[model samples]
Target: MNLTVDIGNTRTKIAVFNGEQFVCEEKFEEAAPQHLLDMVALYSPDKLAYCSVGSGQPAFETALQKLSCPVLHVTGETPAPVTVHYRTPHTLGADRLAAVVGAITLQPETDLLVIDAGTCITYDLVDAAGNYLGGNISPGVEMRLEALHTRTARLPRTEADGETPDLGYDTETAIRAGVVRGIGYELQGCIRHWQKRYPTLRIFLTGGNRYAFSNAVRQNILTDSHLVARGLNHLLEMLP
Candidate 1:
């Protein structure tokens, strides 16, 4: 068995895999290291691959050190199946790269657009030849709503899980619709543009907010919440 941990900006996801087969996954808003330690003790996985884009948790790091199983810390420089082509490779987020790796793992030798709608929405591109061409990041649905409320005076703070119709009726609905639909439009435009370039581009959507925009975006988008975890495990599989 292989264990993969992704400490994202908003939450931490832990997944267990029996080789390439996914077994189970758990998500925590603020991960308790003891709980993770307990899981490690229970699973006794062959390896644990860890990736983080959030603030460092000393407790978790300390706990990781005590674990007997090998823990692989995934970084931008981590050796994966794909070759990253970016000017500032170190600046690239591991989640983004992992998503690309996950896409390739699911559909090898195919042009892919991996979109992760987490704390931030990332759109990463990978060629059919397994090259990570880089991607763009945008504020997530919640972040957009929070920004509007915090930055402005009158606009009320809206949640992503509200009544988001084609057009909003009231202030709250307006904010919700605008933020959600705006992302929909963004996805459509981006997908269309990319499709023009890569005619057979396959779109993969992951992250917490993926379902929120599933209906909004009018495209054939494949979604898997455990994409990053899967990629992390794949990275572990590639290790010498």
Candidate 2:
């Protein structure tokens, strides 16, 4: 068994995978070293791997310091199954790395567009030849709402459902429509642009808001929430 930790900007997802099978999965506001150690002790995984985008947390390293098995800390330099041509590789987000690795593993030998709809919507591309082309990033569903509230005085904070109506009757609904519909168009535009360049590109959607926008368009998007975990497992498989 193996443990995969994805420490994001706001939360950390920990999962126990026996090969490709996940026995337990959880999301935490933050991961403490002791909490990670306790999980390892309880699950007794043979090895552990973690990716972090957060600032220096001594607790995480402290817990790994005690581990007897291989403890791989995912970094920009980590060996990937595909070739990355990122000019500023260090600036690449860990979440994006995980998502790209996930996409390549899930559908090898195919052109891919990995779209993650979370606090920030990211669009990453991997060519059919296993070369990772750079991608674009933009504010996500919630970030758009928050940005609107902060940018203007009269616009109240809008609450979002997974679905936003096109013809909004209220202020909140209008915000929702503008944000959600705008995002949908933004995503579709990217797809169209990429399709013109690479017609066979397959679109894969991941992250928390994937379902909310799944039915908004028909772009052949595959919703797999466990993409990062799958990538983590694939990374473990390639370890020497």
Candidate 3:
């Protein structure tokens, strides 16, 4: 069995996998030592892999070291299942690379476009031969909404919720519609442009706000909220 941990800007996810099969998963506001110890006691995993974008807790790392299992802390320089062709490999986000690896693991030897809608919406591509080509990053839903409120004086600070009308009836609704629906259009445009180059492109949507944007875009996409965790598990398999 393998234990995978992904620490994001907002939350941390822990997953247990038996080979390619996912056993269970959990989420925490923070990655604490006790949380990892509890999971270790329950799963008894022989191997562990973790990736962190934030400044991780030292105690958590110590806890992982104490465990009998060999732990692999994934970084931008980590050996991945796919060959990365990005110019600045060292500057690449760990989550972005992990998502690309997870996409390839889920569907090997296929052209893929992975869109992760979390704190920031990231788009990454992998060729059929498993080359990790770089993609773009854009402000996420909440970020956009907050930007409007903070940057401008009149725009109210609104949360993205409820239905977003095509044409908003009032100010709050208009902001909601513009922020939410605009993102949907942006996603569709990106998908269309990419598809023109790669006709057989497969799309994978994952992250916190996946459902919010997935419903807006018109495309055949596979959604997996645990893509990063799954990728960490795949990375564990590649380690020597």
Give the winner by TM-score.
1
lDDT of 1 by residue, 1-240 (tens): 999988888788899999988899988887679768878888999889888898888888778767888889898888888888988988889888888888788999999999999889999999999888988999998889999999998999887786887888999999999999999899888999999999999999998989887876647789998889889989988888
- Candidate achieving higher lDDT, 2 or 3: 3
Kindly report which residue pairs in candidate 1 clash with one another: none
lDDT of each: 0.88, 0.83, 0.89
Cα RMSD (Å) per model? 1.1, 1.7, 1.3
Question: Which of the two, 1 or 2, has more lDDT?
Answer: 1
Compared with the true structure, what per-residue lDDT tens digits does model 2 show for residues 114-144? 9988878999999999888889999998899
Per-residue error for 88 in candidate 2, Å, reads 0.7
State how far residue 158 of model 1 sits from its true place (Å): 1.6
Model 1 ranges with Cα > 4 A deviation: none
Model 1 Cα shift for residue 208 (angstroms): 0.6
